[model samples]
Target: METVSVAIASIGRETLLDTLRSLAAVTRPAGVDLKVLVADDSKSGAATKLVTAHPIKSLDVTCLAVASGNISTARNALLNAADGGWLIFVDDDEWVEPDWLVKLFDCQKEFNADVVIGPVKPVYPDNTPDWLRRANPLYTDWGHRGKRLYTGRGGNTLVRVDFVRALKLRFDEAYGRTGGEDTIFFAQAAERGARIFATDDAIAREHVPQERLSMNFILSRAVRAGQSYGQMRLARHPDPLWHMVFALGALAKCGVAGSLALSFRLFDKARSFRMRQKLSLNMGKLRAVFGRPLAELYKKPD
Candidate 1:
């Protein structure tokens, strides 16, 4: 099996190690090889000792201490370090299933895709709120019938190494902490007519901490979503109306969902769950419309 090198930009050693353990156990398919580059952005150099000690021989691991915080910048560092034909990305806080690499490779072969994106399921440590679970877009791919190209997701996706190299696609550092770097980067790929594909088979699960489930967290996340969308739209057109249109659409979806959730509190069922989900979405939309500071939104209780 020809080796397919994968460079993963990871921060926080402990979190990344969890992901590495999964990768270490992964059974490489026949005629396939795997290597990992951990772009360690932590100043502590935490991943150095951990990754070096792993017992997987086939897995050539390199942990670079990147003294920076941006995920996009870290990823670019990995792209520069890797010498593989295929590149796969996984977030430091997420773990891929043992068959993850194999399945991703299979999808790449099956579609001959330039970029392949798959599902990202959230793995909560303990019992999670229905709203949080319902709010997650994981466990689903929003693809049109016969559509090959898509807005690529950073986690749980694969890309042809040469294709990325040729296009010089890097997550835009301008997107920064609000985190549309992945979306903006993939948008550029899509614009260049890259053959993007999605499959349900390739899966990676991300852990959502309990802290992230609070209403404040939800609202803050929503604000970030607005900022991301605003940037995307502004990049395409100067019109504020388009932004408002998106904001209104979000609000409507949330209103419908919240209405249903509130109505169904008497009976715990799918509708109730959905209602809570929608309400969250609605609040997000309202934030988008008002263009309030994310910090201020977090101050008011939902």
Candidate 2:
């Protein structure tokens, strides 16, 4: 009978309702209690109305209206109100597996992990490009696989209330606009020596709108990666020379392999295609090295 408080900061009122419905659908194990807290950061009072309209049968949900658009601020507001032993965060636009919370709690207890990062797979209702699907693993960092020790999206993470409160960790408002607040928060935790564990059992499905499938959205998303890469490197290593060396070395390796792949078609088509794709990705990483500040991308309209 462990209690888990799920805190969600919602901006879009329509999406909030959908999230609430999803939470209501999750079936918890006996003796375990689930509490859902929604910090509404919408200008209009639509979120309040939507929460009241919905009849959630499974979990106890509280929707509080707050006049702010910053995700970190809204999340902090929820944290202040939550009373459960563990705090779970989810995006308003995403829904979780029925056993998501149960799996998370189990892993948290087993690993004694300060933070648990779960998988977030994009749920596309319609047709989606193969390349986009293939890029999922590349974009998401999890389980100590990448340079970023903690890489799960904010939507699929569970943190111990005491640890978070002790460290006074809050999502960085700087990344609030580009939606990298989760990244900054995890980085802070990692820096503070928090033990983060990645779990696939606690799964969530993020609904990707059709609009985000376009090339413009894909390319624009690149800016966030670049910004995160730059910030992460700067935070860890202050040496500018090493950063340049690392960037140049990565570009050179990709360039050599890319040129060879184009010159010789001896390898299988699938293998060759993958090499070409790698070349393109390496080029993108290089571009990110010189891209403008992270704040600049926040200026562009989504």
Least accurate 10 contiguous residues by lDDT in model 1: 293-302
| Residue 106 Cα positional deviation in candidate 1, in Å, after optimal superposition | 2.2
**lDDT (CA) for every model shown?**
0.67, 0.69
Model 2 clash pairs? Answer: none
Q: Would you estimate the TM-scores of all the predictions?
A: 0.81, 0.81
Supply candidate 2's per-residue lDDT for 59.
63
Cα lDDT of candidate 2 equals 0.69
Q: How high is the lDDT of residue 83 in model 2?
A: 87
* Candidate 1 ranges beyond 4 A from true positions: 53-56, 129-149, 239-244, 269-276, 279-302
lDDT of 1 by residue, 173-193 (tens): 655445667777887888787
